[model samples]
Target chain A: MSAPKALRQPASLRLVSAAFLAFWCLIAAFPIFWIAVMSIKVPIDAFAANPLDVILGPLTKAQGDGLSLLGIVAWIGFLWLTFRVCTRLLPALVSRHAPFGSAALGWLIAALAAGVLFVLLGFGVLVPLVRALDGALGLEPLIGLTTQHYQAVWVENAFWRNFVNSMIVTGGVVTVSLTVGTLAGYGLARSGSNLAFWILIVALVFRALPHSVLVAGYLPVFINSAEILRPILGDAAPTLYGQPLAVIAVLVAINQPFTIWMLRSFFQNIPADLDEAARVDGCTHFQAFRWVIMPVMWPGVITTGLFSFLLAYNDFLVTSLLLDASNQTMVPAIASYFNRETTTTDQVEAVAAAVSITAPLFLLVMVFQRQIVSGLTAGAVKG
Target chain B: MKFKTFAAFVAPSMFMMFLFIAAPLVSVFLQSFYLTQPVRVATEIETCTPGFTGQVCKTETKFLPQLDENGKVITETTFVGLESYRNVVQPDHAWAAISSFDWRGLMNIDFWKALRFTLTFTLLTLPLVIGVGLALALAVNNAARSIRGPVIFISLLPFIITPVIGALSIRWLFVGDGILTRLMEAYSGQDIAMFAQAWTIELLMLFYRVWHVAPFAFVIFYAGLQTVNTDSLEAAVIDGATRFERLRYVIVPHLMPLIVFVALIHLMDAYRVFEEVVGFRSQAHVISLQWLTYDFLEPDDAGNRSISRASASAMLTMIGIVILLVPLLRKTWRDHKGAH
Candidate 1:
C-alpha cells in the first residue's frame, strides 16, 4: 500500500534517515566484524598500528600463513552450504519424519546431528581439501587467515572442555526452567485470583535482584555442602561447590521469573476459548494444557527457550564466582585467559575463543530473528 | 482454574524460587548483620632453612588460624549489628571529607567511588539509548520496505552478543594501538591511550552500553511505531505541521509507555553493572557496586574473604535498586488495582 500524501516523507528526510540508519548499523555491527577479522590473522598483523596493514596482513603473508583465493572461496562456499542446510533442510527433514508426538525430540536429535556434521566437514574434509588445493596450485596468499590461535585455544589449552561445560550448564538450565516456567505461567494466566496477582508482583521484585547477592548467599552454603549433606548420605556426599549442577540450579532460579513473565504474556495471547473448548469436550485441566494448548505454544516456547539459552550461555558472574577451574564455562574461561600474564599469541587465542562462542549465537539470531523480536515486544506492547 | 490445580501446576516453580532465590535473600540479609572470621592464635615455631654456609634455624612467633582435628579452620561468628554496613559506608571518614569539601578524598573511598560511576553510567546512558533507539525506529519505518529486514538483522547483532564479549571487542579495538586507537592517533597526529585514564574509559563504557542496548529499545519502539495512528499523522500534515512537529506531537506521545518500559528495564540492568568492569579490566581506574561486592568476596592468598562486607555491599546494592524501582512499582500497583 502506498503511504498517504501527508505521511510520505520528503526526499531529503528519507536520505537523512537512511544515512542515520547506516551509521547506526555500522556502529552496531562493526566491532563484531572487526574482531572476527582480527582473530584470523597473526598477532603482529591483527594488532598492527595501521588498520590497512591489519586488514591486508602483508607480514602474515610474508610468514607464509594466509589464505589463497581458492581457499577463501572454498571456505565461504562450505559455510554457506552449512548455514542453508542447518537452517532449512535439517528442520524440514526432522519435522516431516518425526513421529506425531515427538517433533521436539526429533528436532533435538537433528540439531545434535547437524553439529557433528559441521565439525566433521569443517575439520575432517575441508581442512585437508584446502591444504591439498593450495599445495597443488602453488598460488600466492590473498589475505591473512590462520587457525593457529583457534587450534591453540581448542586443542592445546583444552578449551573444548570449557565449551562442553557451557553446553551442559545452558542445556540443563533451559530445560528445567522452560518446563517449570510454562506450567507456572499458564497457571498464572488462567487464574484471576488475588493470590496470583500477589505472586506475580513478588516475582517481578525477585526478577529485579542483582545476581551478586544470590551468589553471595550460595557461596558459603556450597562451600560447606559436604557437611550439610553428610547426615543423610553418610561419608559419600559430595561438595556442591564448583559443580556444573550448582551453576545450573542457580541459573534456573535466576531465569525463572523472567521466563514465567514472558510465557504468561504469550499464554494470554492465546485465547482461553481453545482450552475452554477442550475442557468442555471432557479433557481434564492438565490434559487440556497437554493435548491442546501445548502444540500451539511451541512458537512461544521456542522464543522463551532462546532467551533462557542466551542467559545461561552468556553468564559470567555466577559461573566465574562459583565454578571450579576445571568446570569453567566458555565465557569465564575466556575471561581467565586475560586474568593471568599472557603473551601476544595467548591474547590472540582469547580473541579466537571469543569469536568461536559468538558463532552459535549468530546462527540462532539468523534463524529466529522474527521470534526474538516478537518476544521482546510482546511484554511491552500488551502488558 | 481451581485453586487446587493452580497450586499443583505452580508447585515446582514456586519451590525452586523459594529454595534458591527467597532463601538466599534472607540469608544475605542476615549475614550482613553477622561477621565470620577464622580464629587466630599466636604460636611459637622454629624454622630451619638453607643458608650460605649451613642450615640456619630461626625462632619466631606467628599468628595463624587455628585448625581443628579434621583439618578445617576453626571459625567464629558474632552478631555485629550494622557494623558491616558502617564499615562499608565509612560514615565518619565520609563526613570528614564532606565537611572539608574534599571531593577527591570522598572518591578515594571504594564504595563512594563505585557508586559515583555506577549512577553516572546508568543516568547518562538512559537518554542516549532512548534517542538513538527512536531515531533508528523512525529511520527503519521510513526506509524502503525491502531493506528493513537486513537493517534490523544487522542492528540486532550488538544486542544478542554476550555483554562481556561486546565490551572486550571495544577494549581490543582501542587498547594499546588497536585499530580504533591507531586511527584516532593518525587523524590527530598524537599518541593516545584509551584505557590509561578514568574519563576516556568511562566514555567508552557509556558508548558500549548504549550500542549494546539501543537495539532492544529500537525493536520495541519500532513495534510501537507500527501501531501509530496514520490518520492522526495525515491530519497533522494537513494542519501544516512540520516533520519535527509531527514526530514530537504524534509519534513520541504514542511511544511514551514503551519508553517508560525500556527505561525501567535499563535501570534494573544498569544498576548492577559488573561485566564491563571485569571485561575492560577497569578495577584500577573504575569500579561498580556489584564489582565492589565481588572484590570483597574474592579470596586472597590466605583464602580469606570478607563475607560480611560482601553481604553488606550486596544488601546496599539491592536497596539501591529497590529505591530506583519504587516509582515504577507504585505505578504498576496502581494499574493493577485499577484493572481489578
Candidate 2:
C-alpha cells in the first residue's frame, strides 16, 4: 500500500481531500435525511421558517404527538436490531440453508422472511409495547414524532395498491428479462460470429432510446389493441392499454438490451474450457447451460437481476403512460399525488409516500451494495 | 455453439426486441408523417331556455364528432408529410428569431425552449459529474482504508433512489419555506424563491443531476483506480515527475477510455431529462423535450391528442441522442477494431 515518492500527497492536499469527501457525502445524503425528518412532523414544524424549528418540532410537540424518551430509545433499538438482522443474521441464515442450492432463491427467501418478520415485530409488537410502557411510567412527550402521515398515506390513500402494482410489474420484468437475457447472452458469448457482434451493437443502440419515445410508439397500438385482437379472440379480446401486463411487456423490452449486454459480458468472463468440458460429456447445449454453467453463473445473474429490478421498479414514463389510474405503480402514484391540488396535510402525506417509496431501495442497497457497485463498473470496465 | 442452437437460445429475446423496440421505432417514424383526427360534422341545433319570463329559442351550429355502430368515434388518418415537424420546430419563426439574433424570441418557442434547456443541462453536467466523481474517487483512494466502505455506502444512496423521488426530495428541501431556502433567506436577509424564476430552477436541476450521477462516475473511476499500473507511477517518480504531472500524464491517459464511457452514458441519460420537470413542477418556466412530447400525447377531455406532433418530437429527441453519441460511438468502434 506504500505510495511512490512522487505519488505521495502533501499534508494540505490530504486535508483538503478529506474535507471535500466529507462535503460530498453530505450533499449526496442530506436530502433523504432531511425529507425523512420532514415526513414525521406537523406541517408547521415541517415547513418552519427556521431550520432548527423544523428539527426540534416544538409545534408538533405542542400538538400532543411527540415521542417520549422511552419511545425514542425503543425505536432506536428496533432500528438497530433491524439493521443488524439485515446485514448480519440474514446473510448467515441465507448461506446456511442455500435453499434449493441456488444463491438467488436463497436470498429471495431470506429477504421475504426478513420483510414479514419486520412488519410483524414493528407494528404487532413494538408499537403496543411502547404505548404500554408510556402508560406505566407516566412519562411526558420529549421530542416530536408522529406516524399519522404514514398511516394516512398507506391506509387512507391506499398507497399499498400502488405498492402491489409496482411489485407485479417489477417481478414480471425481472423474471422475464433474466430468463430471456441469460440465454441470448450465453449464446452470443459462445459465438464468435460477426452476426453476434452486430446483434450486440444493435442492442446497445436500442438501449439508449428514451423511454418516452417508446411510450409514444406503443400508445396508439395499445389504444387499438382490442380491435387488433378481435379477429383471433372472437369478441372477448381485452384492451392492453391500461393493464399492468402491457407495462411489464414494454419494460421487459426496454430492459432486455442492457440485460443482454451485461449478462453477455459476464458470460464472456467465464473461460470457454468449463462449458467445453461439460460438452465433452455428450450433454446438449441447454443441458450444459443448465447443469454446468448456471451454477457458476449465479453471481452474475443476481447482479443483472438487481439492475432489471431497479429499472422496472423506478420507472415513471412507461408505467404512468401505459397503466391507468387504478393500476398505477408507486413512482407514478407519487407523481399523481403532486399533480392534484394540495392541502398542507395532503402535502405531508405526499412526503410520507415519497419516503415510503425509498425504503425498499434502501434495503436493497444495504444488502447488495457490493453487487450493485460491481454491476455498474462491470460494463464500464470492459468497455 | 451450432447455428440452430444459437438461434434457439436467442429466439425469445430477439422476438421481444423485434416486436417491441424495432417495430415501435418504425411505427414512430411513420406516425410522424400522419395526422389522425376525429371526423366532425357541423349540425344546427335548436336550444330553448326560459329567459325573462318567456321561452327563447335559438338555432346554433355545433361541430360533433361522428360515432360509428360500436359507439366509437370515427376517425381518419391522412399523410401530412412534415407538417407535424414543421409545427413542432416552427422553422419560419425560428429562422426569423435566429436572423435577428433574438435569443429571447427563440426561447419563447416550445421546441426551441426545450432544446435550449436540454442541451445546456446535458452539456454542463457532463464535466461537473466527471470532475466531482474523480475527486471523490481520489479522495477515497487517499483516505484511511477503514472508512471507505461506509463512505461508499452513503455515497451510493443518492444514485439508487428513484429519480422522481430524488428530485421530489430536493424540491421539498427548497420549494416553499423549506430548510435550505429558509437558511438562505436568513443568511442573505432577502426574500428568495427558488422556483419562481427560470435561472434558479435551472441551477437546481443542474445541481440535482450532478449530485445524482456523480456516484456512478465515482464507482467507475474507483474501479479504474484499482487497475492503475504502479510500475508507471514508480517510473514517473524516478523521472522527477511532480504529483500533478503524474496524475496528468500517467493516470488520466490510462483512464481516458473510462472517461469516454461515462460521458457517453451521461449524454444518453441527460438528453431526455423529464423527472426534474415533473418533480419540480417547473413546466411554467422550464420544460424538456421528453416533457413536451408527453404533453402532446396526453389526451384532452375531448379525447383528442396530437399524436403526430408527439411522434415528431420523440423522433427529434432520438436523433439528438444519436447525434450526441456519434463521436463516442465512433471511438468505441475504433477500439473494437483495434482490439480485434
Candidate 3:
C-alpha cells in the first residue's frame, strides 16, 4: 500500500518541491549566468579578484561590505527558491475551482516571471557583483563586452578545423559502428546466439575501460602505426597518426558494442516475418537487408548516429592523446587555456567559449528532442 | 536468406573487428611482455626477428646476474621469470626510487592506499552523479519539448570539454583567489581555503566533478525516463500511489539497468582519474593509480626506488576492477534478462 498523492500533499509540499527545482535550475545555470554578467563589465571591473565595483557611470564598492560571491549567488538562489515557493503555494492556496484556462494562464505568467528574474539576475546581480569586487580590490576588469570571444572561439580556423575533425571522426565512428554492429546485432537478435552475447560483452569491456587508460594504451599504436603500415603497403602507407580517421577508428571501436546492443533491441522488436517475407521475394540477404531491414532500423540508426557524433565531438582524453599540438579539439584547448598567459583574462570569454561550444549541439538536441527521448526510453522500457 | 549467406553478410564487419580491434588489443598485451622499451621494440624489429624477412626484432629477455650484491659483479647471466611484475610490486627494487620532493608521491603511494582512494572516488561520485543526475534528467524530460534539446545540450557541455579543461575550470572555481574564495569572503568575512582540508577539498572536487559529469547521466536517464511505462504511473496514481511510491515501484525498477551501467562506467573512470587531480592540486592528496603512472614518467621524483610499486599498483587496480565487475555484471545480466 502506498501513500495517496492527495494524502501526502501538505500545504507546503508543492512549495518545497518548487523551491528545490528552482535551486537546481539556478545551480545548473550558474556558469552561463556568470559568463553573461562578466561579458558586460568594463575592462577594469571584470578581471579583479575582489572588492569588486559595479560601473553604472561612477561606481561604489558594493554595499554591505560582508557580501561574498558565494553569498550573492546564494542570495540569488534563495530568491529563486522564494519565487518558486510563492507561486506554487499561492496558486494552490488561492483556488481549487479556478477555471482551467485561468490556472494555465497563471502557470504561463509564473514561468515568464521566473525567466525574467533569471535574466535580470544574470545582468543585474552578476555583472555588478563582478564589477564592484574588482573596484574594491583595485583589480582592473577586462573592459568592454563584445562579440570578440564568440568570434574568436567560433571564427578561428582552429575552431573550424576542430569542428571538421570532430565531424570526420564522429562520422567514421557512426559508419563503422553502425555497419559492423548492425550485422552483429542482426546475428545477435535473429539467432539469439551466445557468440553475439559474448561479442557484446567484449565490446562493453573495451568501451567501459577508463577512456584515458585506453588513450594511454593507444599511444603505442599511434607511435608504431607508421612502421606497421610501411612493410604491408610500402611507401604509399597512409599515415594514420593525428588524422581525423584515428578518432573515427577509436569512436567506431568504442561505440560498436553499445551500437550492437541498441541495434539488437531495435531488431528484436522487428518481426522475423518481415525479414523472411523479403527473403522469399528473390531478395538476397544483403539485398533484403538493404531493402527491408535498413529502413526499419532508421530510428535506432538516427539515435545512435547522433550519440556517436556527440561522443566523438566531446571526446577529450583520446583527442588529447592522439591529437598533436597543432590539432587540438575544443575541449582540450579550453582545458589548456588556463595554462596560457592571457592579457586580462575575461571570465566571460571563458564562459562565452563554453556557451558557444555547447550552443549548436544543444540546439540540435532541441530540434530533434523527441528522437533522443524516445531512444533512451526505447531501450530501457523494452526490459 | 540462408544462414550461410547471413554469415557472409556479417563477415566483413567481423573481419574488420578481428583485424583492427582484437589484434591491436592482443598486440598491446604482448607488448607489455617484451623486455625492451617501445622505441627499442620499433628499432630492434628490422634487424632482430629470427625468421622474418621484413622487420626482424630481438630482445635481451635475460638479465645478467654479474652484479652480485648491489652491483658487486661476481655472478653470471640468469633467466628472470616475470621479474618486471616482481619489480613493479616492490618499487624499492631495480631502479633508484623517485624521491624528488616536488614530483614524487603522486603515484608512489602504497598500492593499497591508491586502490582505496580509487574505489572511494568512484563510490563518492556515484550518488552525486546518479541522484542529482536523475533529477536533472527528469526536469529536462518534463521541460517543454522545445527547450529539451537546448537544455540537454547545455547540460552536457562539461562532458565534451577535455578533462584538463573541465578540471581546470573546477580548480579555478574553488582555488584561493578563485570565484568561490572571492564569493565566500564577500559574504561571511571569512576566507575558506578549499585545499587545506582533505574532506573540504574532496567535497569541492566531488561537487565540481559531479557537476561536470551529471549531465551525461542526465541525458541517459532522461532517455530512459521517456520509455518508462506512463500507464503504470497513471495506474499507480489512480490506485492512490504517491510520486515517491510510484517512482520506487515503477520508474526506479525500470531504470535499474541504466543505473547499473552508469555505475559501472563511473567506477572504471574514477580509478584512473588524472588530468583533474593535477589541475586541482590540493594538499590533501586522494592519490589514484594514474598518479603512480604519471610518477613513473618523471622518475627520481619518488627516489627512483623502482617502477615495481607503480606497476604493481596498476596491476592491482586492474585485478580489483576484475574482481568487482563480476557481481556488477551479474546484476546487469540479471537485469538485462529481466528487461527482455
Candidate 4:
C-alpha cells in the first residue's frame, strides 16, 4: 500500500488531531476520574469543592500557610494552559523540522506536561492516600480520606452478599450459554439444511426483542412454578423466585443468540477438512468437537465467554425483575442505594458502591482490552 | 449428516429457545386478548337498626371476590378480544380530546406520552451517536500508533460499563449539587437543578445515552475504517482531494453498510429504552412503553398484579420493535437472496 500524500503533509493537521484526541480522551476519562476522586473525599468536602469555585474563587486566610484561593486557581490555570500548549502548539513546532527543533522540543514539552500531571495527581490522589495512611498510623491527618464508606457498604449494607450473588449469576449464565450456544452454533455451521439458515435468522430477531417482553412472560411462569413447588419443597420453593438459578436461566436464554452468532462465525473459520480427518480416524462427531475443535476454538470461546459474563453482570432489567431482594445482583443492588426510603446520608456510600461495581470491569478491560476490541467489532464488520 | 445426529446436537438450544422465547411470545399475544381479574360476586347483608318506630331492617350490597368450594378465591380470566389494546390506545378518548382541542389531555394518556418520548429519544440520538462515533473513529484512525491502543481502551470504557451504572455516574455528575451541576451553577451564577424539570431530565437522559453507547458505534466504525481500500484512498489523495472530500467520497461510502448495521442495532435497542429510565428514576416524568409494561406488572397494594395490561403493553412494545426492524430485515433478506 502506497503512503497517502496526506500522511506526509503539514504539521498543522497532526497538531489538530493530537489536540482533538486529547480533548476526547479527557471527556472519556474525566467522569470516572472525578468519581474516583469524590469517592475518597468526605461527603462535605466532596460537595464543597465545586470545579467552578475552585477555578474562580478568591483566595486567602490559610491556617498552615497564607495561600490565597487566587494562587491555587492561577496555578491550575497555568497547568491547563501548559497542557494545551504542549498538546497543540508544540507538536506543530516540533513537526516542522526546524534546526535543533523536533526531538529536543518534543522531549522538553513531554517533561513539562509530565511535571504538571504529577502536581495534579499529587493534589487529586496522593494527598488523600497520605491522609488515610496518617489516620491509620495514629497521626494528625491533614485531609479527609476514610474507608468507612466502603466498610459501610460492604458490611452494614450487605453489598458483599449482592456481590457474591452477581458472581454466581454471571458465572452460571456464562458457563451455560457458552456450553449450549457453542454446540448449537457448531451444528448450524456444519449443517447443509436450510433449517439452519432460518434458525439463525429467527435467533437474530429474538436478539432484537426487547428484554421487557420476555421478562413479562417469565413473570407468571416463575410465580406459578414457585406456587406449585411449595407443596414439594416447602421453604426451598422460594428458589424459583428468589434464587440466582432463575435469573441465570433467563440471562443465558437472552444471551444465547449473540453467543451463537459469534461462535458460528468462529466455527466457520476452521477448516472442515480437519474434522473429516478426525472422523477418518474412527472418532465420533462429539469426540472430534471435544479433541480436535475445542483446542483451536479457545480464543473464540474466551471472547464469547467475556460477552456472556458482561451480559449477565451488566444486566439490570431482567435481573431486577426476576430476582427477589435477597438474591439481587450488583447492578440492582447498587441501584437500591438510591431508593427513596434510603437516607440522604448514604450518598457517599452509594458512590463507593458504584465504584466497587465498576472496579472489576475496569480491570477486565485493562487485562483483556485486545480481545474486547476484536470481540465488539467481530459481528458488525465483515469483509 | 443424519437427522438424528442433527437433532441430538440442536435439541437443547431449540428446546430452551422454544420454551423461553417462542412460548412467551405466543403467551403475550394471547394474553393481550384476555382480561384477567379477580372474580367478583354481589352479596346481600341484612341489618337491623333501631329507628323512630322500632327496629328497621335494611339490606346492604357488597362486592367481593367469589370463593370456591375449597375456600380459595378464583381469578376469572375472560377473553375480552382486543379490549386490552383499546384500553391502552384509547381511540375514543384520543379522538374526543383531539376534537375538543385538549392538548394536555392528549399528552395525559400514558401510551401517547410514552410513545412520544420513545420516538423522539430514538430518532434524535440516532444521528448524534453515528456522527460522534464516526468522528472519534476518524480521529483515532489518524492518531499516532503509540497512543491509539490506549485511546481505544479508554473510549471503550463507557461502552463496557454496566448501562445502569453508566447512567447513574452521569446522573451523579449533574444531580443536586453534583460536580457538574455545581460547576454550572458557579459558572452561570444561577442554581441549575438538572433533574427537576421534564425537558432537562430528557436532555440529560439523551446525553447520557449517547455517552454510554457511542463507544459501541466507535468500535464498529473504527473496524470499518480499517477495511477501507487503501488504493482508492491513495487515488483520491493523488487527485488532490481534501480530507473531507476523501471521507465523503471514498471512506463513508465504504463504511455505509456498517453504518446501517449500527443504525439497525441502535434503533432496535433505543426504541425499547428501559434501563435509562430505571437508572435515572425518570419514570414519573418520562415513562417508556417498556417501563409501562413493567409498571403494570408491579403489584398493587392489594398484592394483585395487572398481568393482562402488562401483557398488552409487552405485545405493543414488540410490535413497535418489529415495525422498526422490518426495513432492515427486508434488506438482509434481499442480500441473502442475492448471495444465493
Best by TM-score: 2
Question: In candidate 3 chain A, where is summed lDDT lowest over 10 consecutive residues?
Answer: A55-64
Clashes of each: 0, 0, 63, 4
Query: Least lDDT summed over 10 consecutive residues: which range in candidate 4 chain A?
Result: A57-66
Docking class of 4: medium
Per-residue lDDT of candidate 3, residues B1-340 (tens digit): 3467657656766675565566655543443444332111112223365565675565544433334456543422233446655554555531234444422443443443455566777788988899987877666654446665546645645555545545555555566655657888788988788777667766766776787778767777877887788667778888988768987899889888888766766776666666556556552466566665544423365333233333334444556667767786787688668856
Calculate candidate 4's fnat. Answer: 0.68
RMSD of each: 2.3, 1.8, 13.2, 9.5
lDDT of 4: 0.78
State which docking tier applies to candidate 2.
high
Candidate 2 per-residue lDDT over residues A1-383, each given as its tens digit: 67655667789999999999889888988999988999999988889887778877898989888778998899899988988888778777877879443998888777777778888998899888988889899988888888889999999889999999999999999999999999999999999876788788889889888888888899999989999899999789889999988888899999999999999989989898988898999988999999888888888998999999999999988888888898899999997788773777778889999999998888888778788999998899985
Rank all candidate structures by their TM-score, best first, as comma-separated numbers.
2, 1, 4, 3
lDDT (CA) for every model shown? 0.89, 0.90, 0.59, 0.78
In model 1, which regions exceed 4 Å deviation?
A78-115, B44-62
Q: How much native contact recovery, as a fraction, does model 3 achieve? A: 0.18
lDDT of 4 by residue, A49-131 (tens): 45633222222111221223333444467646654554455555644653331243343344445555645774576555544
Q: Write the per-residue lDDT of candidate 4 for residues B1-340, one digit (tens) a residue.
A: 6667777777788888888888989888888888877798899978899999999999999888998899978887799998888888898988899899998898889988898899999999999999989989988887777889879878988888888888888887887878888878888998899887789999988988888888899999999998889888888888988878988999999999889888888998899788889878897788888888888787779877777888888888888888887887798789778877
lDDT of 2 by residue, B20-88 (tens): 999999999999999998899998999999999899999999999899999988999999999999999
Chain B TM, per prediction? 0.95, 0.95, 0.67, 0.92
Clashes of 3: 63
lDDT (Cα, tens digit) per residue for candidate 1, span A1-383: 99777677788988898899888878888999988988888999999988888887887888888878888898899988976786578767976898765565666677667777888988899878887888998877898778888898899999999999999999999999999999999999999998888889889999889899999999988988999999999998889889889889899999999999999999998999999999999999999998988888877887898899999999999998899898899999988788762777777887898999998888777666777899999889998
DockQ comparisons of all candidates to the true complex: 0.82, 0.80, 0.17, 0.59
Candidate 1 local lDDT, residue A86: 63
